[model samples]
Target: MTRLRWCLLAIATLLASVLAVPPASAAQDPAPILDPIPDDPAPSGLGLVLQEVARLPKSEPSAPPTDPRLVRWNRINHVGELPDGSGRLYVPDLNGKLYFLDKKTRTPSVYLDVKATFDPDFFSAAGLGQGFGFVAFHPDFKRNGKFYTAHVEAGNALTTKTPDLTPQPKTGFHGVIDEWTATDPKAGTFSGTHREILRIGFSGRIHNVQQIDFNPNARRGDADYGKLYLAVGDGGNGNVGDNGGDPQNLAVPQGKILRIDPSGTNSANGKYGIPADNPFAGQAGKVGEIYAYGMRDPHRFSWDTGGSHRMFLAHIGEHEIESIHQIDAGSNLGWSEREGAFTFRKDDRCHLYPLPADDAKYGYDYPVAAYDHDPPANWDCASDTGHAISGGYVYRGKLPALRGKYLFTDIVDGRLFYTNEREMKQDPTGQKRAQIYQLAAYDTAGNPVTMKQLAGDNRVDLRYGSDAKGELYLLAKANGKIWKIVGTKQYAGCKPGPKRVSHVAAAKNWAPVTPSKWRFPGREVILAEEGVQRPGPRRPFEYAVLKSGPVFASARIDAEVRLDTPVEISNRDVIIVFGYRDDTHFYYAHLSSDNTIYPHNGIFVVNGADRLRIDQQWNANRSHGAPPAITDEKWHGVRVTHCAGTGEIAVYVDGGARPVMTALDTTFGSGRVGFGSFDNIGRLRDLTVRGTPAE
Candidate 1:
């Protein structure tokens, strides 16, 4: 199997094995299965209606602030801000280059090239896994220049007379935590000194250790300055023996958050000393480093601003949940015992040991916020569609607009919500009294605004950070865009210009594409098109096609079209009349720049005819045969007509009736048309795209 496939399989197998084992605690009564919420009903009316409060006025600072420039990196899994006011973004790319972003410039530069810094054989021998963790700067980083990282390291072979069945060779440490020192403390960059702090072995990648965060509130000048809090996921393959959720276990460090002082001592394996205050430091068999235990996939977590009595952990779950737990020493989070307030295995027969009724609450830690699979509010966890929760810090910054709010987001849903400590405490019983408002839209001035509807919703995991003063920043996962929530009051009520409808004709120089004409709700737009005479070398090309609606569409072209290069018809529609024509077919539909196809099922052309026809019996399909013949070498007029009720599609080529098909559903809805090579090459000309909303 491919490496990626192997990794995925390993992860799946691990999860299965971990969860398949019966929980230690089994209940006498049958487990309570919460009733699923109705799909169409409005959200439960239990919470405070935030809409009833007066809307906060948009900030009106004199000079509008500039948009924060986004830093680009390969597979940025997490980000953390230094206490010294600088930001460090960690990318666990396959190649293992650690990147640092300068908060001021929003530019990314390599902080540490693991390949160059570590012994090359380390990875070759250990069999490096995907870079899946984080790098944390010491609390007193200004003077200490110490930072720590958690990552996968190959482990030594487990020598048994009988061979193991798992794919992992008898060799390799699945995960390791390392501490390094910067060469120069005064320098603004990270290319200074280096050191290996510690290494912990794991079985595989899944449930590997994720991040290490320092207690921001820890004593600054004390020996604890470089002491760290490490969040380790249940070590790969969810084996109960990994001791993932059991805080009492001593043989394994799989599920625990470890506390250590990097400068303290040297052990048989490496450097770093365990803090005496660590929960289990003096215990006989337990790893002295563990601070707390009982967590699933602790992908990301953070200490609140000002660091007093608050920490957030985003725990990944299997079915029905993802949670944010508040940290406390010796906390038993009930991983195999429970998943986010719900019992996973409740039958007494399923377990060898029974846990207390309040297992998760027995220890010092508890989940501050937890949600189930319900929609319109909590993330859709039951579907297992959401992957991980990306924990974020509470916004305790200089920006008056977002101060005093706890901001956290899910990596899978891209939803941002804020809650007060009081509100979070009240959500334990699956009942909430506070409204979690969606951060719907941002005004042009960059102020947050509640929209009539949510837009641009996608699975863009948002990474969070804060500056020295604790101002909040967001890193969008989809495009690596960075947005700073700033106060702005300058609003120019400018209307958009007219739409330039065709690619065959040259775009009028500097013409404005009006918001109304372009059919987008936004205030600005620019229209441009390019046509190539000769086919370029086969390569991926990114293009933006504008449609007069809410969606953007894109596509790739491997071959030619209309007697040019042979175009492969990957996407097609026979129902909509006016769409792009590839070599094999005319789309007869509007496509968004993001590759969303919309069918305008109103118009159609008689099959094999040179006459335009409006037919209600048209059907849309991907395999509708070759596009109608084009008379000219370049530029052909195409029209699509759709009938919503009849589910018909008609296509006209150069105003001549051509093909008609019946759509399985309504073919047309009023929306703009966007066409171009999504990630590959193709050409366009004479594209007159228009739309009217479905009435």
Candidate 2:
């Protein structure tokens, strides 16, 4: 017993034989038999369903040597986008599965498993939990495939060696939100139908509620189109109870954000309803499923792809502030009596109040972005540097080259910033300047932050995404990588030879090109092109593959490249190609010889039988930090490839994954690539070169 509890008792005996099977019903009364042909009114035409294809040939250029078996499964924690566009990712381990992934071939599968739905005492009365928020769906989720989830449940009569001293099972709460249905939203597997809508209960063990979402302004046939919104948090250690922020209390719902409406008709008091436009429905006795209220650990929240009904929260503070608010409907925010724009436990004695004075004009809302902990401006929050601020989004789609920038971070110094509400209200003494980067940040706040010279390390957790045109995506919560936000055309005077990598063939018209020549003292630089097309929220193109010694290496092809920071050459021979804009972290695509630097952590790929060392780490503070080798205005990526006799290396990214590092000994023979903005500012696209043979 041990090996992680024998892999958790063989994944709880393979999820109890895949939940013992049962589903599949489309209603009885089957049968068709018949022949009735009438009225061929000779005036009808409307048919087109084509399906038949076979065209394969042009994809040559394959010097083999690039497969090293690859294996990485840190297991997902959160991932989305499935309004039909596909892609669902969620794996709160402890055998709590949900999977799905396949936005084409990201390959995943599982579907659902919490011990086959529930009741082995649900895991010995509350003791095997996992699965925290984000599933929702239901905009008619492709014609009623429904969908909902908010997990965290266990059982064993409730533990403590039980004996019914009021032992668990008051419906076994520890946070539950269920809903399910999916008999087939284009099929993958999870023969749906389950029910249990709301349950909330947790005396400790951190925040709990986690996420829910679904209300991008909602509408299409209304009725709150599946209204949800949740968020919770403030149940763990950080004092507040006494009925927390009292929304008039209802025996505690913990610091609130709810919303409900799961289809309506309130089933005898809970299973969803409360939505007469919410805001205390009929007042008098409140709790109509709260919409907003003072929060103390709200984690993450978003909605603002431009349509602007605006929404964005990310509270979480205990010592000094760390905020980002603006969300209404019943608004209250100002937990423990304000902690962001200032004033917290101010002289204790309780009794504090003051919101609604244009608190962002009416319904309470302040913090388009915040940061504080006393300092010469951020001396690593002085001490206790863990968890505070991790909510991001705002760069509405089609990268008009990063239109409107907003992004956000700080799950323990994975600091990556970007501002724009007019530099966040003219920089409130916090100085205005953002375009900062150190391998695109990630470290899900479990306490981990250290970096002064940036070496390499990660626990990844930058979770949050959106695509299918609404743009936004940043999920390197520790390496599930997926970044999308692009823009280019900023080269200074380009002229770092290798034929400028053949002018990167103009990146296929998504247009916005640049590169005529800039400060290039070269090590290798290229930017050639051929039908590029990668950037997305929808697709665009440019070209970049730069580097500039003194310590500023680089790489840029947009769509992916985030490595937080740390690079050591020592003996040369590096490569790049990255992905994992979230799931912890990993982002790069760097190479060298003439120019190709994108080093947030010199993209790793070692394992010549067994050497394992995949670099990238940068923190602002935590158990002594270092390894982000700064170089003024930072930007990095470098690449190296040599075929035959076995050698393949890679690190390409704008978001994550392309990592492939193997070795036999080729130490980059014959140089000359292109692009090097070592002076700062960068951009690039598709530049290609394969197998290298003709001299």
Candidate 3:
């Protein structure tokens, strides 16, 4: 057969396989199928909505007020939630002011003024990416009131001259990550502590320290808990061309991702502690702080807390391809040597570095996803793919269709793309894997608006943010707007069925009817009494078991819970009991509390009234982030799946595809399932559990 005929046959076969599934039943499946390549990838207009949150503060009179820089009108860079759990949004402008907006009231206020505290002259570069870079609240910020900020500082004190061309000490400034504390976190202001955590010096000011963040879910015992990850650029001195050597150099902090304990003192200067597990720690002749190296400018990166804790970073490419990478601890992201899976050379006009025959020996970490620039003949205008790439989160929000999709966008063109995280890793070439989709954002009029159009300009400078609930937002620096992403509820051909085998609700019709359904007795046991069920107050061993009839070896259990009061970590737990063989033998999971062994949370098996954590690999010091906040009053979706055949147990929250906790153990075969808590008052509803019938 001819090549064309063979291709046609292949397409027909794929179509048959996909179209064979009935649309009515497809929605019942646990996973959703995405259009690998939509026929009209850039169909007509838009599909998303952008709502402006707040505008930046007006420029001061002392500066050139008329200049656009003074207005900082459209330069909103980053957005995050405060640790106080107030649910307010915090935004940083490149001009040096930290603005906080209470989304509920739609009011914006200055939370902290970095320019006023630091010498603005040091960060007074004309570039758009300069000045105050980013801020991250410590994981324990709620309790410790500690936070860190990355900004440009005036002094070259931390910089060492490069020996040859007009020593950098005289020509460069510094990028500093300063730790600050708030005596009263609710006061909306920071205490003037200002402890210097780390600093990167630059000959020119484009790629300074870009971001500082801690794993929000990290608990005390997790490896990543209290560890701050900082990304630095190659100290690009645009004034004199690239004064480059930092990305590949280990001694300097620039062009690398550094992980340090913000609260511990183990450094030579005793400011911060070097994580013992860092990739370069204890290595000879290398900086112990380096987590990964050889990066030009890793502008933005986020941890996939809802999934595998893998980090995805969006690195700006040099001339041709913009790239995205999933980094490993000691991974070497080739920068000066390569760019976005392509060879990169500063001096080469048609810059292309030939891949070495023995590339594996180089220990280079190539981008998992990338898009080439337009104007193939000569690099000219922005191609269909935008110029700069912006990193985003793995969508684990309430949007069922978007679950597990890694969302990213172009800073210049403002085109947002969502790719299957698993697929991206499986097919790194990204050719057959799946080309990035231009997420269509629409307005109330049903008119499709380009991301650039939403920002009212081509220079969107798009950035992404995720609230505590994992809902994502897009920040348009050029338009000075924040867009909350709202996905279509009923996904095409993937809407969940109405009569769920696992339907749960907090209403009367769904209440437990028999003694066997809710068979535990305790003082706080109000199982579905007043429109809700309290298995027991948060206390030790207070459990309400569903001792009714059904039992299974493999099962899927889902429950909706609401915390009536605050959660005290030391004495609070939302436990889901499963695989119960008897009263003294069963498996239960602490869904949202930290314990010493599995700091974040884990599953424990009770044998003869003796409880032992079965999933130690996912326990404390092994996991990242604190447990999910189970007592926040908002209805939280909890799911537990166990397959005895594979001895695999997985847990999910908020309908996220990614399992927050997982383990494989065959200690117990099958039994009953139930729900309860430790020392906290919470309401539970929709306790629906389904599995194959027991023999």
User: How would the candidate models be sorted by TM-score, starting from the highest?
Assistant: 3, 1, 2
The lDDT for every candidate, in the order shown, is 0.45, 0.43, 0.64
* TM-score of predicted structure 1: 0.54
Best by lDDT: 3
Among these predicted structures, which one has the highest TM-score?
A: 3
After superposing all C-alphas onto the true structure, candidate 2 shows an RMSD in angstroms of 27.9
Query: Tens digit of lDDT per residue, candidate 1, span 1-695?
Result: 59999999999999999998777644254444443211111111011111110111111111222311111122355545665644443333323556556554556666666644543322322211234356777777777777776655442222321111112222234455666777775454566666556555445545666777776665757644567877866654443443334423544566678777777773334466777777777777677777777666676777775535477677776554667777766666666565665555523312223233565354334356654444323334333445456667777776554555566665656655555554555233433333332233344433233221121335564556555566565555344445555542211111122222333223331111222121111321212222222233221122233433332122111111222222343332111223322221223332211121222223232222222323222212221122223323343454444323323333344544223222223323222343332222233443443332333
The local lDDT score (0 to 100) that residue 250 gets in candidate 3 is 77
Q: How well does candidate 3 match the true structure, expressed as C-alpha RMSD?
A: 22.0
Error of 2 at 446 (Å): 35
Question: How much is 221 displaced in model 1, in angstroms?
Answer: 4.4
Across 76-97, the per-residue lDDT of candidate 3 in tens digits comes to 6888888678887788877678
Clashing pairs counted in every model: 73, 121, 29
